[model samples]
Target chain A: MKPTSLLLPLLLACCPTEACEGLVIERAWIREAPPGARVMAGYAELRNDGASTLVVDAVESSGYFDHVMIHETLLEEGRARMVPRDTLEIPPGATLSLAPGGLHLMLMQPVSDLALGAEVPLTLRCGEAVTETRFPVSAAAP
Target chain B: MASTDRSALILLVLVAVLAFALGIHFARRTAPEAGAPVEGMLWPDPPRLESFTLDGADGKPLTEATLRGKWSLLFFGFTHCPDVCPTTLATLRETVKLLEETPDFAQQGQVVLVSVDPARDTPEALAGYVGHFDRNFLAATAPPDRLAALTGQLGILHTRVPLGSGEEYSVDHTASILLIGPGLERLAIFSAPHAAPELAAKIGQIIQFLQDSP
Candidate 1:
């Protein structure tokens, strides 16, 4: 679902805090891709700090990339298949990890090359609540 | 006189059968011994590869002869693949380093990145991508049909996945790394979640075992 129309207000409400009230992001990193690479992958840990479950319905990184979507690499029948994830929910007091060779943020069509140590902003929407964080670009996991 | 001829025919048949049995016995004795079981590797019956031609990063033909005389480690992936491809190539780099450090380990091998997405991964782009990981690493690709011919026999599967629209797509591909023997035969299959140390150790042992066999 294209939730950008509604996410704009949520983005305004949240001031791009790394440690927020409901949900917090930790150890976020964007893997540095080779020059002329059209796509890159980002990973982070999504932790639910509040009593209720945090549902991330959509993701956006407009200025840096054409679009961002949650994708998973599944090893099925000896092949790696990229499956898009529309919604992801984290239970209360639980942490969900997006990592290499697993669930990750598939950032497509970068406006320019993301150099090492560069930070890219990303926004996540969970209904009316929104959380934003910046992920540092690195060759390996941070 | 007819009875005498029949006896001679029976004697000739017995001598031929004895020679056949001896040949089987000697051949079995001289066959190579299988190595110990290694993690993440499957040494099925090695199959001879079909002759196929692909263009290397330098626009030269990379045929089966190019892979002869060296152990070839082949991975099928696209340069645009952001997650799994980089992870695998890095793992392979680490694996190669471990192999080099070990003494008596035959380090005669080449790592090749065979692009499944040739439409986007031009020869120059692929060369740059593989070089970022290691300068010695090689990359090659061909037209879709030629690529399919090579991939089909090696059991490498790849398909283009469209992401949204407007000239954006990702490739879903086989994650296993293939080992080609120096004799141009498919040797082993290494499954994913590859650890550098384990992979290097296993490969070193497998190669040594084969060389020392018979």
Candidate 2:
């Protein structure tokens, strides 16, 4: 069932999936990292704009980092595991979010220094019409 | 937005009570002579817990009773950790959520984030930062000398370094999750790659054993 009106405010503030209608990415950001740390995480909401379902197989970015893959964080017996997703799909007019403490993107092998405020250019490949986006690396979420 | 406090406190006491009983159970010399005794395996025996009274979020007294009769996961970290602290804490929150959904999985322990970067992580800052993950988490810190003594005995480590920002700095420290059981003993431990379900399962089984014993 679609979330109720009670969720409208949150959806707008957080996901904004409806606002982006027709397959859009809303508010993608790289949660800040520690000095000299190799791994970093990304979060976003992918909203499907049409009546048809959409499958996002892979993502690409330019001049920031090369490899970006979908992964989910799970804790089993006190150990954290990162499970990779071959692809993520969203139903018609639905938004799928890559959030902290759950499914997210692991951006590894940075091509250059990801200074604060630098936007990582991204390309989300969903079939032929790829949607482009940017994720600004900012201070750790408050 | 839910409270992990009252329920967690209740569960913690229940677990701790059960654990104390287990501590006694393990201490007895045995091979049941006349009775069909309850069956169990000791994954590992726990270490004797020492008592401590220290300051908490408010510069008030916090003591060994602070952990009495409850299983607590204590993590030594600082607020400045841009990655591990938050990530690990969030994982603990998820782990707690997973336990809640488990059938009869009693939430007997608390997740305590103690700031090793005491110079910067004032109790208020520590509390605020940890509350961002889950409200019930205990965010505590003490003076550098005392903090060093407590953490050192626990095998936790911390060291400060100069950041390129001239006066500003950063700290590197040991990041291990310590499991404190009832009777205040340090129980089974977990390293990085903190697995939630498996950890919960083991703790659940431990709790069950603690509950079953007289």
Question: Candidate 1: lDDT of A131?
Answer: 79
How far is A68's C-alpha from truth in model 2 (Å)?
Answer: 19
Q: Report the lDDT tens digits of candidate 1 across residue range A1-142.
A: 6889888778767765343456889999998888888889999999998998878988889689988888999988779999888888899999999998899999988999889999999989786566789999998887
Residues B22-55, model 2: lDDT tens digits: 9878767464565756443454556655665556
**For model 2, what is the C-alpha lDDT against the true structure?**
0.69
Per-model lDDT: 0.86, 0.69
- Model 1: residues >4 Å from true position, as ranges? A1-20, B1-45, B102-107
Give the interface RMSD values of the models in order: 0.8, 8.3
**Each candidate's chain A: what TM-score?**
0.84, 0.77
